[model samples]
Target: MPSKIDPRRSGRSGGLRWPLVWNVAWRDLLSTLRDRRTLVSTILLPLLILPLFTLGMPLLLGRLIGGQAAERQKVGVVGTLPAELRRSLTRDESGRAGVELVSVTDPVEAVQSGEVEAALRAVTPLPTRAGEGSGQLELYAKLGNLKGQTGAQGKVESSVQAYNRALTLSRLEALGLDETALSPVTLRPVDASPAQEQRAGALAFLIPLMMLSFLLNGGMATALDSTAGEKERGTLESLLVSPVSRGEVVAGKLLATTLTSLATGVFSVLGFLAAGLAAAGLRGRSDVDAEMMQAMGGQLTLTPATLGAMVLIVLTVALLLSALLIALSIYARSYKEAQTYVTPLTFLIVFPAVALQFADFLTIGDALYALPVFGSMVAILDLVKGQITPLHTLLASGANLLGAGVLAWLAWRSFGREEVIFRN
Candidate 1:
């Protein structure tokens, strides 16, 4: 009898292995193309939604800022002040321009009507020590909205300061003191560094989060379809029957998924940049320069090294997410179950991404720097803040990549297990 051909040992060498990987990858890509609904949902959703959000956000913000600047702010004044003192309070002479001082019978009403950005309730002078007749006047306005309410507060503060100065001058005239009494203190505010100034923009935070969101969203869908969809449709079993190594199968699926995710991320970023630039350009009255946006985007480019780092970051995250989702989806009983499992993952990321935007406190301690998603967030923030120190970037990237690698390995291990691969 002729020796039986061992199919398992057939072509187990190097030449055919790569081709197998490519074939697997190609088949998955083609299958993806055939699913027009998924294709449209993944590709077109980001293409349309990202630009819409980016363009609309700036316009909304500009309207809010401009409306704030144009509003007639109400201010309350207390104490038995002469008409001259009140007139001086709201006039340009006192440097209190662009304010309308309304004498309020009720500070609550002023605030409630939104007539006042904030209300200033003045209290009587505090009792002074033995010889002093009176203490300085006390005033209060809303504190929470300090940035928005500052201009309105400044008007009130200046008016009080001016009145105090006039009172001092009257006393000096009565007692023969000089103007030198008013020169006690001065304040100087230094400007921030050029890098800090340059980094200030909506894009600083929005860009990175948008990049992350697109990656996760794209990766999740690809992972689910490749794993659960295949299992549910009984195609995965056929693929497993081929003379392909499990590693090659995984490698091919992972590569395709990462590419799909990366492409989505890139398109989203470009759309964001384009929509922002176009919106800025369309605003003829905006302080942002058209040429400046063009130059900033073109000349101050993310270098190839930085771009590579960013791509690596995105791909690593995508691969890990794809792998993890695939493992989960394999265990999921149905497509609806897989979708239900992944819904929380979407919201799970959203809060952290939003927190990353609002969180200003930074310890820079080693432990905080070592945390998983938070580290990525901190690194991206540092990158945006123009403080992408080489050591920090390397460390953060190393940690994230290491974690992703571990998770990917675990996913691959899960894929090889019959119990996981064929779970009900």
Candidate 2:
């Protein structure tokens, strides 16, 4: 009698096959989508979190700082002030008196009692005659109130400097000398970089760090659910018994996880952009005029090429994180156990993500580009700063893919082991 072949085992080629991989991947994707908890944790959470940090906090802080700056300041005077010096201390160059000067017996008590933001005490009486000696001026401010201290100290210093300049000019005229004779040269500063580059420098650290964090967080749930979750449900054994080879099964799961990770990353970027636009709109109502809005919009503008590079970086990071997460999840015996195992992995990702926020402190070199998480972070940071080098991009991308492949192989090997797959 001829040996009979089992139809269910007929497609087991003992190697990777595309059709089998696709089938497994599709099933995993569908299952993940149907699970509401996984969907929300991976997709919805990032969309909410990114916008809150990017838009809300900045607007709140801006309002607080602006309010503090716009309030009128109060200053106390301890001793009699000369007519000319009093005018100089009370009024600005534009003749607007922002400081309200009150005569106080004790300037220190006035500041301590919160009666004035700052106080000016005359160490010596002011000169009444043109040829009289200059008087000493002492300024006191409440050190506890930083905003009050800065404003009061700044106004007092400006007034003193103005008085000094005017007195110097008078003495120079008495000496039959021109004011400019004292200065040999004048210095002017010029910033050659474009406005866009300046704005990008401010945003470079935050954008990449948030993007990478979301990419990692977005894939984490699906990775754990697809592996450890299935094992906990007793469905992994049934899936393993299918005709598809173990490598094909692992590949399929990785593909699904990667897609989920990419989707989450894209959503996070969109959410952040939307939040920024909304913030701009709110600011335009009062703080931002049309000219300012136009200038800011131009500064924040991103080129299509830069956006493409960001997409590439996000995808590569997602692939690397998803593969590693899946391998870890595969070794876990239960869903709760997988979460316990993966929780610490987040810290690993966080340290590098935080480091990207200080990208200027890190050197961008071939060696950094060859490292795993650090390399991807540097590449993303360069892209945001508009300084991405093709060689560095290629190196970082290759390193990430190579690392993903290794983790994927480990996942496949774990799946092939009956003990690991069925561990409970």
Candidate 3:
């Protein structure tokens, strides 16, 4: 059994030594585990709250948004379609499909005031502007949510096209022109599975990104709470006075943060898989059901290399952020004050990550595969799409790990300085 030495005794036994690091780390970990708030935040929250908030919540919201956009659409009709023709149009067949015509107005105001989910304007005449050739029925949707706008537009356009086809045939017969003369070429669109198209629809992208970001975010909270939070609570000072080298202290704290981060990532991923499985079983024969459930039926899995890379990246990021946060936290007087320090650090960690969210999946290329968070996004997108290139994966993982190393070194150096650690 290891004996605890009192720091008060400055005899050789009281000198800072290797064992203090374990002592501090063990105490911190145990104390943290016992904390209701800490347990909830570190373990339970990721397992429970993240799935509900990030995955389930977003899915529900998407449905509501899609539903709301489909109901009571205000439409502006222009040109020679005629009011009688418009009145003859019955929405009974389409209304249940979520297309309710509210009112007609200027396209711009309808979109600006949110009076309509979209506006249908006649295309402006020109040598033709960029999208003008899309023809007389123009759709103006707020903020360019192309999916909803395009779906709604398709319904309206299909109705109009059918009406036009009927009228054209009547006119051709009355004018003694062959109906065949109106045809230039036969047209048919091949309807294929959305899966075959590799349609990385909104939810696919959102789920993974949400998982990665929240795992890191929640991990950050754990890191800060474990280290800096201890410092704020005055518990760290007690440990620092004991026998431990600064390096061991850093190593142990790094281990704790890495574990916390990995836990968060794993729990979040499990939640995603669980929800996905349930959704698949619930959807039963719906075309939107993910092919992953069938292809990898009765089992959810990640490739070993992919899982390794993800773990490495999350660990590196968590350690780097924790170190930086701890260094910053040392400057504060209390836990509350440390929170203020962490607020900006949180922003720093989160803001750079936003670039990942907006990156174009269709346009991803090598250069972006080298950019920091952008690189992670590209790598992850590739992973989910089942097309991860080992070369790109290594390069991105290397860059992120290398960057994290530099940040961790800086933080370690800061922690070593007594002036920094005890800054008033």
Candidate 4:
């Protein structure tokens, strides 16, 4: 049996020794690696989740939209069609009349009651050709019922647009003007930055959130198991009685958890890369490829410096999260209790990740990069876009390391508290 450190030798023992740290860390790391739970969370989950989600999501959405469009919808038209339009136009290029036109006594009530998918009302007389009165047409659908309508709703809207355009042309021709008379200033969009198309794909924005999620999910198990699990199993006392300093013990657990999380993040990255490659392979083969390419945003244009910066940022975040989890876990009496305490930390990533979608609108300053999870996320966002801001990376990394140091210090102190260690 190991013996506890004496107060007389405490000063000397309090000093960190790498050999002792490694010994303690190795014991936990070896046990964690062998555990099936670690294998599932750290290896299998990371390797599959991203690719399956990124690749499968687009396909699923496409199926849903296409299926919605395919289902013939009931549209209520309140007014009669002009003789000319009734004869000449049954469907537009998108295959009009794809919907069934029915007469409804109450258009509003019909749509509200689900008697029709949508309703169209001509506020004025229908214009068949040039030299006619131009007016508005109202198309009504259940706006709040997005799920049931989805892509199929677009067909109803387009029919109304066609009606409005037809009326405009008729009015213009009546007034002796051309179609160009509809607008005094027409703006045509041009590609100002073709290079951007080659850099960040639409999917790149997800990288930051995914990376943080990887750290949290992959590291949480190991962190909880090492700290709370040891205490729960009544094994913490045996380790505490060893000659290892409390600081060294905390450092060792932090190191092990950080390493495990980093590995999981790496595997998650690999899953994304694999997804990208799969999309690239399908490029130009069919419309499926087009949809996937658009979903993926663009091909990876990452340079080594960018990858290195990502790796560096990932490491820092892992360290911080690992330490935070360990600290929380050390304070809990049981593994279940530790989980309840640490699970709320998910909101730390959830809020920033939700914000990442609107990144184009936000103006983030350099100092913001010094925030904990949010900072790393922003830096990684820039990195994913191939922006490679060294200052941002440096700021985020420095902040994360500083925060980790604080948390690790607290955990180290916690390790020395008998009440905390043996909490019932």
Candidate 5:
């Protein structure tokens, strides 16, 4: 009998064959594109999430809070207020307070019932004798209603402070003392950060985390389907029996997945930019005025060089994650099992991405640039802040690519193993 030719053990090449790799990659890409689930995950989801977060939520919040500011607020007063104090509460130099002072027997109940935005209860009489205590004013606002708790309550507090200051001044003058003597020291705060840094601070964490999530989610469905989906459908064995080496097959699938991932990320960024442009245009109308347009323009400060660096970082990270996902999926015997493995991998990516938001990128040392996902996140943040150095970018990209190479090698090796490829 002649010895059988084992396709898996035959036609092995020490180096990658581009033609076979390209053929395999093209096929996988076509298959993934044909799948509706893959298209939705990699493309549509980012389109929805980016606008909802960056544009829709901000506009919604502004409307809610802005509406609250413009409306008249009701404040329940528990006791009869002095004529002078009542006049002060109703209006001042800034203008009339947009508040309705209602006399209520039960101030807290009025607040709880939403009849009042806040309540002021008299605790004690104003200070008179040395032993006597100063008058206490208790303000109550519903905690769940943020507008009431913050905006209305803040306005009431400001009025009370002004009243207290005036009263203190009167008492001191009656004693023939200067009002300035009461305040021995004054303090003021200065923000040292540049305007660009301040704007970047608002968006640094959000942009990077969004990009990381899109990069991972974009490739996950395709990665699992290419590996375990084919295995469960009985097509993986047929592919393995072909003349192509396992390395080339793995490389092809990796390329396809990387491309899908990259496309998702690119589409997400484009979607975000489109949404931002729309918002800018809306804010640039003649009614909005030049100051508003200038302010909106200042928030988006990406230069050509920064955009190029960001694209490079996104692509490299997508490649690294794609390989890892492929390797993990290869171990799964079925598509469902592969999904279970890939789900936890999302947490691994998400947690670090979220945590990096709170990280001070400026203070973080260069050693952290050696980490895979974390390094890429930091580099993206640095780029956003316009502080990324060439060396830092090189280190992060090198580490990420090195890790990807290792994962690709492992996946290729797994493809060559009979038990893994055909495991039940």
Candidate 6:
């Protein structure tokens, strides 16, 4: 009798076969690609949306809000501007600088009422002699407003900082003391990162989360469709009745899901690359807030080594998520039901990624490298900072692989169950 499965993707006879697994995976993948919309959303959405957000957003915001360049911001001052403050107030925070001082009867009320961008309330009269007395001022701006904080508050702070510096120097001169007395300890920051790390940027923190997000989103529809969708469509029984082993079928579906997830991650990395390039291109331009651009993402230089490391981390994540999602999807009788089981897992990946934003403030122990998703997150974050610690990377990837193995085993067990297979 002729074999029921392809010789290229399945063994003539099998007890857990790779060939059969690949065959099943390819079959499901082809089915998924037939849905042209999924193909486009999976491949093209990230490429288009990420660049639009990263690059286009600032330009959109600049024109809409008028704070990126030398556009003058309104800052209310309750008292007369000292000679020192007058020069400082001529500038904002980014680009060359621009600030328009507006005298207000009520500085705080002016800011709250939107009559001013920010307000500086003078508590003490402007000192004529720096050594004789001190000047006190209160700065007010809407704390919850992003534009106000980033644009107006930044300008006020810079002017006040400059004013403080000038006053300090004058006081030192009045006291007949050298500048050295002002600082018992001078801590100068030095850049110790490698040349390739020049573009590590603030957005590096998002790389780990980006990997998780793509892996989760990219593979989810495929995983649900492969398991629950097949079951709901009544095709799962036919596939099960075929000559292929249950483990082989599960392995195939898992592989298909992982590939889909990996594809999403690849596109996501491309988006990150695009955003980085856009930031670099805009960094030196005069029309935009170049300083803000650098601070936000700066130059995003992902070295070949970093890309390789990211691939390693993403692979482990895809595998783990694929197996887990497959297991959850297999337990549900309907596609919509599978979504209920799988939706919460999305939040599990997210909360950890959000917590990583404060990674700089936290102390990560060596044991964290052995965790599941968070471990991979840490490894990816290290790669983002241009810090390649091989042991941690290996540990995290190995842990994810180990977890994936267990989940894949559970999924294989589920496929073997008569009740599970026919659970509709």
State which candidate has the highest lDDT.
6
Candidates ranked by lDDT: 6, 4, 5, 2, 1, 3
Q: Give the per-residue lDDT of model 6 (tens digit) for 265-338.
A: 88877887887777777656765445456545523357777777778888998999999999999999999999
Task: Output the worst ten-in-a-row residue range by lDDT, candidate 1.
Answer: 291-300
Q: Per-residue lDDT tens digits of candidate 1, residues 32-106?
A: 767767576567766777666655555555555444444545666545445555665556642125567666766
Give the per-residue lDDT of model 5 (tens digit) for 1-424. 3224375444464777899999989988988889898888788888777766666655565556555555667888986565556666666343224567898888878888888888888877654332345778788887676777546786787777777777778777878997778877877887676644554435557777777888898898779888999999988777877778777889899999999999999877776676556556555343323223333321334578877777878888999999999999999999999998988877776787778767864568888888898898888877756788877888888888999999998897788776787786
- The local distance difference test score of each candidate is 0.61, 0.73, 0.55, 0.76, 0.76, 0.78
> Model 5, 263: alpha-carbon shift in Å?
0.7
Sort by TM-score, best first: 4, 5, 6, 2, 1, 3
Q: Model 6 clash pairs?
A: 9-19, 10-20, 92-98
Off by over 4 Å in 4: 1-5, 8-15, 83-97, 147-152, 167-178, 181-186, 191-205, 281-301
lDDT of 1: 0.61
lDDT of 2 by residue, 1-424 (tens): 3123333443335557888888988888998889788678676776787666655555555554455445567889888878887787666443223577888888888888999889988889977444787788788886676576447666677777777778888888988987887786877886565544554435456666677777777787778888999999988877776677677778899998899889888887777666656645654354523223332331223468767777777788899999989999999999999998888876766787777666667666688888887788777666655677778877888888999999988897787666787778
* lDDT for 250 (candidate 4): 86
Write down the lDDT that model 4 would get. Answer: 0.76
Q: lDDT by residue for model 3 over 151-263, one digit each (tens)?
A: 45555655566556666676677778866897878889774533411333343445445555555555455556655576666666565655565556665666665566666
Cα shift from native, residue 209, model 4 (Å): 1.8
TM-score of each candidate structure, all chains considered together = 0.69, 0.77, 0.67, 0.86, 0.85, 0.81
For model 6, what is the alpha-carbon lDDT of residue 113?
A: 88
Preferred candidate (lDDT higher): 2 or 5 = 5
Cα error of candidate 1 at position 168, Å: 6.3
Clashing pairs in 1: none
- Pairing residues by index, what is the TM-score of model 2? 0.77
Q: Highest TM-score, which number?
A: 4
